[model samples]
Target: MALSTHVPDLAALELLLGVAQEGSLNSAARAAGVSQQAVSARIRAMEAQTGVTLVHRSPRGSRLTAEGVMIAEWAARLLEAAAEVDAGIAALRADRRARLRVSASLTIAEQLLPGWLASFRAAGRVGDAAPEIVLTAINTATVITHVTEGTADIGFTEGPQRPAGLHGRVVGHDRLAVVVAPDHPWAGRRPRNPWPVREGTILQGARAA
Candidate 1:
């Protein structure tokens, strides 16, 4: 028989993650602000859709099956990505009374921007509430283009090179280090010389010789 194509809803996914963390249906339901019966029904419905026995229920409590653990992990990742998408959409809304427009690379958007924005709000730079911030995540080249064209008030990018026609300041720096297992041959080697080359060249060399 062909597998069902039904995808679990975000709420159900969240419930599964809660169950995994809380380790019991009653506790998961309480944390979710729902009744235990509701949690049970939702889990049953999810199992029916996926055609998998996800949870093992007994008089003691409820526990996830082996498949349930794997599915729950994936569900957690999906929910996290969904949250980022929601935040990006809120930032991109044109109707907001925005005080700042920022264009950033994916690394900055995913890793740094949220915390910085939270700090800015906490500092009360604008007021008790956060100033409206419109943000876009794009490539480094696109970030430069946006800043140069005045489409964004500020831009964040990686790499040392800066495009002309824009005043740049280094807010932070990151260094790439080669990581190897302790047992690997290169783990004990100390480089006598270091040289800079295009990233593509390094990747090609890794693949070739």
Candidate 2:
């Protein structure tokens, strides 16, 4: 079945995640125990729905466009929460109050979560916790808002600052990259020096200036 990109509709998100991790549609299909055709179809469907060219395909393999990379990062978090839910449930089976509140970025919310929840549900092992798992998805800005407001118990985001009035744990790390097209004259040297010297740019994201 073809996947949709407008919102990834669960199955499509899974496919995007597989492709991101595997780096090749064929490998993703193999790992997923599906056919290459299926993977291709999924990608096509997503691209159509989202109206974005998400993948750059070449002989080497496939790489994500900016949006694709963003989506993949988000999906990883959703995947993590799903894992926690499963572990919590497994622990609960042995112990019933195993609930947690997870706050994530919009990208993670849309691309790769339902499957994790679905898998946990399929396990059929109930958690001992209260069984109320709340999920909230917001941007880097709103995550801080949720944290500051004490509305969220946990947060996942790319923001480097530790906002006041909340405790944060580094559940994941992501690095921004500088990309220069292959046709550019600096492609060779660019690899050697990923970060170019700054001229007038000021760094505002870091804490304490």
Candidate 3:
């Protein structure tokens, strides 16, 4: 069940607990690093919120009435649970930032990524606590799949067209060199115009020509 709207908030409960522990508003404010008036106001707000007179204040000091002591006990337990929740969330964030999952095409992984990661670290862009890099080398399609499926944090692949359903930008460009025998006629041709060759025949027919 949801907590009732009448329940005091965590801050107010903390202030109430402070008063209960310190035995006086002035001492509670000192322990909390707030002014005595702020602590007194917080206690009054808690009382109004819960409709219970929580603190009995006198010139001598302050004290928790019987109802106030019981409420303070419940607040202690709730605060403990809140602390555990805070710790759990912090651990998850630390784990998420501590490691990176990267998927890349095999060629890029083998030829480029090592140097890129080294440069990234040298630049200190990710701060002194760099995440551990977990690299997976696969075919380009699989790399795209990993990224689109959310199995990978990021992916690197070589192609002119962007994969569907994913955001991407070209990090770098690459080229394929057509090597030929020195004696071949095209070897010395050095044509200024781009070669007009089909994708399939670029390598095979060039070698034959």
Best-performing candidate as measured by lDDT: 1
- TM-score: model 3 vs. ground truth: 0.71
Candidate 2, which ten residues in sequence have the lowest lDDT sum? 200-209
TM-score of each: 0.45, 0.38, 0.71
Show model 2 residue runs off by greater than 4 Å.
Answer: 1-5, 58-61, 90-209
Candidate 1 lDDT, tens digit per residue, 28-87?
A: 999999999999999999999988888998888889999999999999999999999989
**lDDT for each of the candidates?**
0.78, 0.66, 0.77
- lDDT by residue for model 2 (124-195), tens: 545432345688877767766665555665555655566554555554444456678999886766365444
Residue 174, candidate 2: alpha-carbon lDDT: 41
- Clashing residue pairs, candidate 3? none
lDDT of 3 by residue, 1-209 (tens): 99797898888888888888888888889999999999988888888888998888677777999999999999999999999999999998787677778888888889888998888667664567568889999888888777767677788887666765677766675656677999987797776875543111000111110
Candidate 3: segments with Cα more than 4 A from true spot: 118-130, 139-151, 161-169, 179-209
Sliding window of 10 residues with minimal summed lDDT for model 1: 200-209
Tell me the TM-score of model 2.
0.38
Q: Assess candidate 3 and give its lDDT.
A: 0.77
Residue 132 of candidate 2: its Cα lDDT?
A: 53
The predicted structure with the larger TM-score, 1 or 2, is: 1
Which candidate achieves the best TM-score against the true structure?
A: 3
